[model samples]
Target: MIVADGIIELDNKNKAQGSGTAGSVLVLLSTYDSRVNDNNAIHLKNDGNSGVIYAGNGKIEVGNGNQIKEATGWKIKLKENTTVTYGQGMAGLFFTGPGGSYSLVKGTYQAK
Candidate 1:
């Protein structure tokens, strides 16, 4: 899905699945004030299949300011057989944000 210049609040959990055994979540944010916050309270889970989540933006001020932009309260759980892929051009997924905490419950990770 696309969030051009707005707010995407994932209150509980957000999910996406593919046709068979593969699926993906692609987020593209333009050079506007677009933000995605999970309140550092939810788990974005990709389970029982092959899936990828790619969120990219020219400007993502994660943890540079307010609580909404901070990754201090972020939680991402990749169950078995799931992967969160990151590209050389992408920035947010590779960094440890505020709270400076990340726990890998399960699954495999790679660079693409």
Candidate 2:
């Protein structure tokens, strides 16, 4: 999982490869915009693997020759020649229940 508070800019020829038996899952979480500039900018996949990119409150722009499994954002722009294969069993992984809540872990925080 790649989490960013701001923009995530991926240059040309960048790869976020994954490996495993359950296949691989690459999760890109950003609070701001994520961009892939130029052709061949990113390759977010491994054979038969599942990859997911999520931009919480921002947009995602991908360049040509890029490959991915799935992507979700406020706005998504894809250049020519980009490839995306939506894999199976991916729906359950990103499900958010209604009224979900979070609580802080006890004793994990330290005062500065």
Candidate 3:
């Protein structure tokens, strides 16, 4: 997991790569903007699955030719030709704050 208070910039020169076994999730959480501006700049993979990127209070800009699993932010901008594959296994994954617990909502349980 990567938590940044400010901007998180990723380019060809500075990339974010992930490699590990299954269920090894990578989380990039940024309070500010997160920019990925290059081909193959960020390759986040866990076995055959991908990772997550979240910008809590800012925007997320993804350039072309990069592979990302899922991304969420206040605003998201994707340049032409970016690849995003959603992992079904991630649907059961949830993040919680300190001392938080899981709760049932609409017949489904999730972290709160």
lDDT of each: 0.31, 0.61, 0.59
Cα lDDT tens digits for candidate 3, 1-81: 777776665654344545567556677777653344322222232222235777755677776666677787766777666
Clashes of each: 1, 0, 0
Which stretch of 10 consecutive residues in model 3 shows the poorest summed lDDT? 38-47
Native-referenced Cα lDDT, model 2? 0.61
Which candidate has the top score in TM-score?
2
- Off-target runs (Cα >4 Å) in candidate 2 are 20-22, 33-50, 96-112
Residue pairs that clash (backbone atoms under 3 angstroms), model 1: 40-73
Query: CA lDDT of 110 in candidate 2?
Result: 28
Off by over 4 Å in 3: 33-50, 95-112
Error of 1 at 96 (Å): 25
Candidate 1 residues lying further than 4 Å off, grouped into runs, are 16-23, 28-31, 34-83, 87-112
Candidate 3, residue 93: how far the Cα is off, in Å? 3.7
**How do the residues 84-104 of candidate 2 rate in per-residue lDDT, one tens digit apiece?**
877665664465235443444
lDDT tens digits by residue: candidate 1, 1-112: 3433433333223333333323233442332322343232222332321122223332232221112211222233333433344433333354654555455645655433
TM-score of 3: 0.62
